[model samples]
Target: MSFQNTASFPGAGIPEQVSFDRKELSVILSLYGRMVAAGEWRDYGISSLRECAVFSVFRRTAEHPLYRIEKRPKLRNRQGQYSVVGIDGQILKRGHDLKTVLRVLERKLIRAVD
Candidate 1:
């Protein structure tokens, strides 16, 4: 029996995973910290997928995420690369600028503090 060598295939070794960069994470975490301090958010999860990266924010560990921040590089030119999704699967905001997209949640944070 002969087995085919998978290593000979092009792009076989490289994983096409997408994830938040240092600067992006820095911006997200800054908001997360503020929300946590205000008692609006608690648990969080990060997922790096082949197509997009997601940062999910949760009020509790077991419950669904209150929001999802997604980065889709493919959408960079079409609808911007960054997006904020609400719990109901609605696109809260979308833009090329990460900070601009996150401002939706920041508004919530302001309301949360009030």
Candidate 2:
């Protein structure tokens, strides 16, 4: 007697995974560390969504995010690939250079002390 082979089913659509590169993470974490030391930030969260990836900073666990660092690969060809959104949902800065994009938040850190 011969054995029969099982049939294959339809393929499922897999969602694209979003992630931050080493250099990108380095730039983000550098700012985050400074904010933490300044006491302006206490907690942080990261999200990898379909269209973009976000790094959220919070002053408190239960409160809204104080800042959001976002990376949208689609925008790389246009305005930029990196963006910083304020708590009010406004785009504080956007540019191709991660360091330049993060300058907006750094300004806040400066005036926060002076």
* Candidate 1 worst ten-residue window by lDDT: 105-114
TM-score of 2: 0.82
**Reference-based lDDT, residue 9, model 2:** 50
Q: Rate the local accuracy (lDDT) of all candidates.
A: 0.94, 0.89
Q: Which clashing pairs does model 1 show?
A: none
Per-prediction TM-score, please? 0.85, 0.82
Score residue 82 of candidate 2 by CA lDDT. 93
Which sections of candidate 1 miss by over 4 Å? 1-9, 12-15, 111-114
After superposition, which runs of candidate 2 have C-alpha atoms over 4 Å from their true positions?
1-15, 111-114
Query: What's the lDDT for residue 8 in model 1?
Result: 75
| Candidate 2 lDDT over residue span 23-105, tens digit each | 99998999999989988899999999988999999999999998899999889999998999988999999999999999988
